[model samples]
Target: MTAPDRFSFNQATAKYWPIPELVAGCVEAGVGQLGLWREETNAYGLDKTAELVRDAGLAVTSLCRGGFFNTPDWYDENRRAIDEAAVLGAPVLVLVSGGLPEGSRDLDAARAHVGEAIGALVPHARAAGVRLAIEPLHPMFCSDRCVVASLGQALDLAAPYPADVVGVVVDTYHLWWDDQVWAQIARAGREDRIACFQVADWITPLPEGVLLGRGLPGEGCVELRRFRDAVEAAGYTGPIEVEVFHAGLWARPGTEILARTLAGYLAHVD
Candidate 1:
């Protein structure tokens, strides 16, 4: 069977796009899914933002974030994020396992901390009908941002949880460099652990200390069609949310970036 259609855009890309205008632009572009951010949601207020999306008839694929597990006092913060996801009817909460504590040498310890934190919040997430989507950042981000740095690793961390409560996001920019990505995708499919499938191209020689250099779909070196096919073969039919974090792209007009992004996705996906 042909893969079912599922495409989404994260509003965070439109950081420069005014909320009302962005919603209208997304609707006009025929983009059906969105990933909302906590700061933006709070700024617009949940009710107003939801009404805007509702008026545009958009489906919220996932909330931008809900975890920063390295924090010593992150529990309450995470709980509040869970509540917000439920309020917005977002099915998944993208988690970026936080960085190492100051003067700490133990990466493994930080990862363990992530496990403990997620374990603590799983019950609350389930209660709120929010699936925790563990996003394995690229290994380049291992030191400062995410300890979980591979799709396989994220899957291993989430294996014990019930499928509906936990799963993994397969982002092309993050996992495309892995030699074993296809194998991991099959494993995720076998276990039904794929929660979100996102995309952005990988750019090299990344600037110093800057974590966000994501390229537009066709601008960088990624095997887009192969990645999409593997994820589809693994039984994930969720929206393909394009999450580019480029400063250049972000500075451009929202409508132009979005229009180009949609065209690029269609060009590369098939």
Candidate 2:
């Protein structure tokens, strides 16, 4: 069997799985790459998690988010996140530029704040050898989840920093709706700003909080292969991290979830 080199199973796909068990499962199943969330990583113990993954001979593709700039403690939190990524040997620290701060509808101010916040973290990120990857959430999440709602927006915010220190995440679920996403991906490539690439299918009838609505690749309407082609064409040669989030999927066993995620990736992405 020809294994997928860049097929990384994001830990969130099996949201409730114990980190140690997940690591063991990945090793057993021949999955060499993974993406992780801070909360889970922290719960598993930062150094412990790093040691576990290292011992398993797995590669930590990217840490799932270091940014929430709108928060009061963003400075310290982000620096801590950078250190965490470095500790885990993860090269990328995903950034979810937080949405409009409490009761502040001024989108312009909020976006500007995000840029400045990232600028402040650039030095730390560079020093730690971690790239801050800005992820553009869907527009529906712009008001409360992320202000960077499009690839173009993400690219714009990352423009002021060195491409090595700041870059963008290419997620199909979020960028599929944008007609100009192709152009933006190309621009990101031209500028060497593609830090990471994530895969998730877009599904409808989102949950109440609208957080757990993603589907496995080929389970939704997204053009998964097309997005993959765009990212590859745009010069992104890193791991294609599969990061689907959904309540139903979370209810299953981690092993089963990993199997299904791999099947979907082979059918729809690779």
Best of the candidates, lDDT: 2
Candidate 2 per-residue C-alpha lDDT over 1-270 given as tens digits, one digit per residue, 9 for 90 to 100: 234999998999999999999999998889999999899999889999999999999999999787889899999999999999999999999999888999899999999999999999999999999999999999989988899999999999999999999999999888899999999999999999999999999887666656888999998899999989998898888999999889899999999999999999999999
**Cα deviation of 37, candidate 2, in Å:** 0.9
TM-score for model 2? 0.98
Q: How displaced is residue 121 in candidate 1, in Å? A: 1.0
Best by TM-score: 2
Off by over 4 Å in 1: 1-5, 205-209
Could you tell me how far off, in angstroms, the CA of residue 216 lies in candidate 1 after the best superposition? 0.8
TM-score of 1: 0.95
**Predictions in order: lDDT:** 0.85, 0.92
Q: Estimate each model's TM-score.
A: 0.95, 0.98
Pairs that collide in candidate 1 are none
